[model samples]
Target chain A: MFAPVILSIKVAAIATIFAFILGVFFAHLLTSRNIPGTSIWETILILPMVLPPSIVGYLLLKVFGKRGPIGAFLLDTFGIQVVFTWIACVIAACVVALPLMYQGAKAAFQSVDETYCLAARTLGSSEWKIFWTVKFPLARPGIISGIVLTFARAIGEFGATLMLAGNIEGKTQTIPTAIYYAVATGKEDEADVLVLIMTLFSFFMIFILNTWLKKKNYKVS
Target chain B: MGMYFKIKKKLAQFQTDVEYSFDKGVLVIQGESGAGKTTVLNCISGLKTPDEGEIRIDDMVLFNEKTNIPVKNRRIGYLFQDYALFPNMTVEKNILYGIKNKPEYRDRAKRKELLDYAGYMMETFRISHLKKRYPANISGGEKQRVALARAIVTRPRLLLLDEPFSALDARTKETVYEEFFSFKASLGIPTILITHDPRESELFADDRIVMKDGKIM
Candidate 1:
């Protein structure tokens, strides 16, 4: 009972961290430089959110499966298996939740005055220092909300996590998976408890996130 | 011998073909809006690339048909028309921001020297009282002073101003311009100022060029 809740929290936390890092990094790159075919790359990065979660899970399995190139290399060289493990759950959540964080960060960065960046450049600051000191600090509010959104999405992930990590009773079961299993086994009372807990957690996360965003006067589109 | 640019660039509606050589003092480029005064400044500062151009400052070729120097290495101080101060930083931090890239930024004594110099500049500009305030909290004149302090703190070889006083009121403008003139004489660096204010041209311009339709009239 508590095991599934703990696992979900752990998986979401790890996935949100990874997603936050990649999202901010990509957001900075996408906003600062004029890359050719920028819209195409942006669309590709955001595809996971638009697509069905099951499809994302399946894609992950294909790449990280034992017979697949990456999975085969890992299995042979490092004696490590990722699929059907807790790591797979984190990976699946990260894939599906990244777009929200990326979009949020990108919008925040876009609203910053390019002239300030140009001024930093003229002031003799390297791109790296300017990003950390100027760009990132100004965009903090939106990025913080993005992180909250990512965690909420990751914790509630069901279809993708199930497909990649499996619904093992003790090892891989998360809150969503446990709720589904409980209902399937005619344990309606247990399913109701899980559903109530998930709903309350999601509501709290959103409530706090919204209040923080409002306090900062950040309009996250 | 000071700063030179022979350049051509095509814009949406106008094509710029300009050639100028400045030896010293403040050179004012007076023009109406859309006359490409800002564009010329951008080109010289390495913020905008021209299709065909050669830029030489103090006998060193900054850009030509074959070479384009990056903005950081150009050592040109540009004061934007809007006074682009970093919104997240205090006035002191903003002024110190550029000096981090200088060679002396790493040396303890040199860093102290730069900081002391920056403090002196802030005092001179009458912005020492506003040092702890963020850009968003400062008045327009204060913001301009902070921006100016940041630009000159790096000790740039060339100073570029895009309507530096356009945002200030008449009284504040008078005071700021007075400070600017005194500061300009002390530094003795070549400066390119773009403004439509005839009074600025009358009082401060050492050599003036009238720009119309992207060319010197």
Candidate 2:
């Protein structure tokens, strides 16, 4: 039970980091002017968030299975398997958490004044440098919120992780997976304890994030 | 060694046509509201593409009907009417925003020289103590000074100011103009100052162009 909790944290941490990097990139791409097919890409990126987790897991499994296209290619080339592995769990978590990060990051980026970017550009910084130095700093609050939300969503993931990675004890099993396992095995008392822990942890994370944001707002203002 | 450009563009209610050149003096554009003064500055800075025209700065073509270079590549500095300082940056960072991490031309020596110049300007403008402050935490006059510092620190080939004193009080504007003129004399960089205040135009202009109905009169 405790093992699953640790695994859940590790998976969520990895997934959050992955989602944050991609989310910032996608958000910048989405907000940038003159990018072709940006609207279409934005819609596609957010699709996983709205889709049912069970369906997402099922789709992941089909694509990453032993005989599947990507799976077979990996196996033949590098002797690696993805299906039912902890890596699959991370993939599922990242997919589920991506939209939250993207949305928050996009909002944050949009709130900055265009003049700041123009100023940096005229000062001779390249577009990439301006993004890192100016845009990213101004958008830090939103990015932080997105990361927290991604971590929460990744830790609470169950349906997709189970279908894609399988709830292997001490390996692929996370907090939500452990809860499912405990319940299915009629360990009602253990399931209750895990459920309480998850709830408390989620509440604490949200509280901390909100408090930190409020303090930051006060400091800036 | 400044440059010249002629711009013509069709807007919703006006057709902008202006021909101007900046040498080594303060070139002021003066007119009332809706007179297309800001548009002229915008066109020169490559913020707005003209329908038909060319902008050349220091023998480098910024835009022509056949080709358009983006604002990022243009070596032009602009000061917005509202100062437009990045709210997220401290005064020091804001001043350095345009001059950080260039080649030997923009190294620590040049940066520190500009910073010292900026610090002197700040003291002259009464914002010397707000170096660690953000825009939101500073007064309007301070914000304007910081904006000016940010624009000038890069040593742009052309400096465009859009009604820089419109947001400040009369006393503040007087102090700002005094500091600004001293800084201008030191750099000797050709500047285009946009203003609706005829008094301001008379006070600072070495050459004046009046815009009415989008055409320079």
Candidate 3:
């Protein structure tokens, strides 16, 4: 019981960190100015979010398979394999959860008033300084929202996790995968407990997000 | 030194073709709404590039067919119409943001020296008591002074004001105008002020250019 819970939490936390950082970076790049065919790139980036979990899992399997390009490169260069490992779980989680973070950050970044940026520029601020001081702080609430969504999505990841990281007892079986096997094998009580726990984790994150946004809004107002 | 620029930018409503020069004191560029008045200020400050032509301040070229200076490197202080105060920063931090926050002032002694000037600006602007407060907590006139302090704290050679008093009430504007004159006299930097108010132009203009549909008339 605890093993699945702990593994799920650990995977989700790690994936959220990676997703949030990369998502923000991608958002800033895509939104800052007119890039040719930016919408097309955005559609590509967001494909995973709308794609069925099974298809996403299959795609991941194709890329990270033993004879796959990335998989082969790692094997040939470093004698390492990515499929059916702890890293596979993290990779799948990051891919699925990344779009939520990206979408959230993109809207937040775009909502920043151009006037503040112009003011910062006129005040002798470097672009880097302006981003850290102005854009990031101004967009922080949305980014935090993105982090919560990413964590929730990552923790609840099932189809991809099942395909990439098989349902081993303690090493690779996460809460979602464990619950699936439990329900399939007629362990209704175990499945119920896991479902309750999963719902609680998601609710807790959303509650924290709402409370934080409310406090920030109150202060701003 | 005086500034000169001849620029042509095609706006959706009209073609903005204008040429002007100024030495010192306030040069008021007056126009009706949609006359591209604010666009002129944006061009001078390098925030918006002129489609074609040259901009030069004395011997230093800011923008031309061959060269376009980055906005930060232009050292042209712009007090935006909204005041555009960084919402996350306090009054004191906003005022000192131009200099102390940058890498060149990383030295303790150098920053200490600069802080004296920043303190003088805040004191002169009568915002010493409001230093700990954020922009949202401050009055309209107080926000004006803080924004003014932030713009001039870096000691730029040029200053641009985009209807800086527009957001203020009549009562606040009257008091701010009094402070602005003294501040301008003490600094003696070249300033270009954009406004639609004739009364404001009458009070502030050392020289004036009236614009009609993006053309200087």
Tens-digit lDDT string for candidate 1 (A1-221): 88899999999999999999999998888888998888998998899999999999888889989987888999999998998899989999999999999998998898777887888888877889889887888788889989988999999999889888999977889999999999999999999988999999999988988887777752211
lDDT tens digits, residues B10-120, model 3? 999998999989888989999888899888888889989999978999999999999999888888889998999988888888888898645658988888878888898
Error of 3 at A29 (Å): 0.4
DockQ of each: 0.51, 0.53, 0.61
Please state the error at residue A21 of candidate 1 in Å.
Answer: 2.4
* Chain B superposition TM-score per model: 0.95, 0.87, 0.96
The C-alpha stretches of model 2 lying farther than 4 A from their native spots are: A218-221, B1-3, B10-14, B32-34, B57-62, B65-74, B105-126, B169-171, B174-187
Error of 1 at A7 (Å): 0.7
Give the winner by lDDT: 2 or 3.
3
* Superposition TM-score, candidate 1 onto the true structure: 0.93
Model 2 lDDT vs. the true structure?
0.83
* lDDT (C-alpha) at residue B65 in model 2: 75
The clash tally of candidate 2 reads 0
Better of 1 and 2 by TM-score: 1
Per-residue alpha-carbon lDDT of candidate 2 for residues B29-62, written as tens digits (9 for 90 to 100): 9999988888888888877888888888777888
Candidate 1: residue pairs that collide:
none
CAPRI-style docking class of model 1 based on DockQ: medium
Model 3's CAPRI class is medium
The sequence of per-residue lDDT tens digits that candidate 3 reaches over residues A36-154 is 99999899889989998888888988888888888888889998888888778888999999999999999989888888888999988888989999889988888888899999999
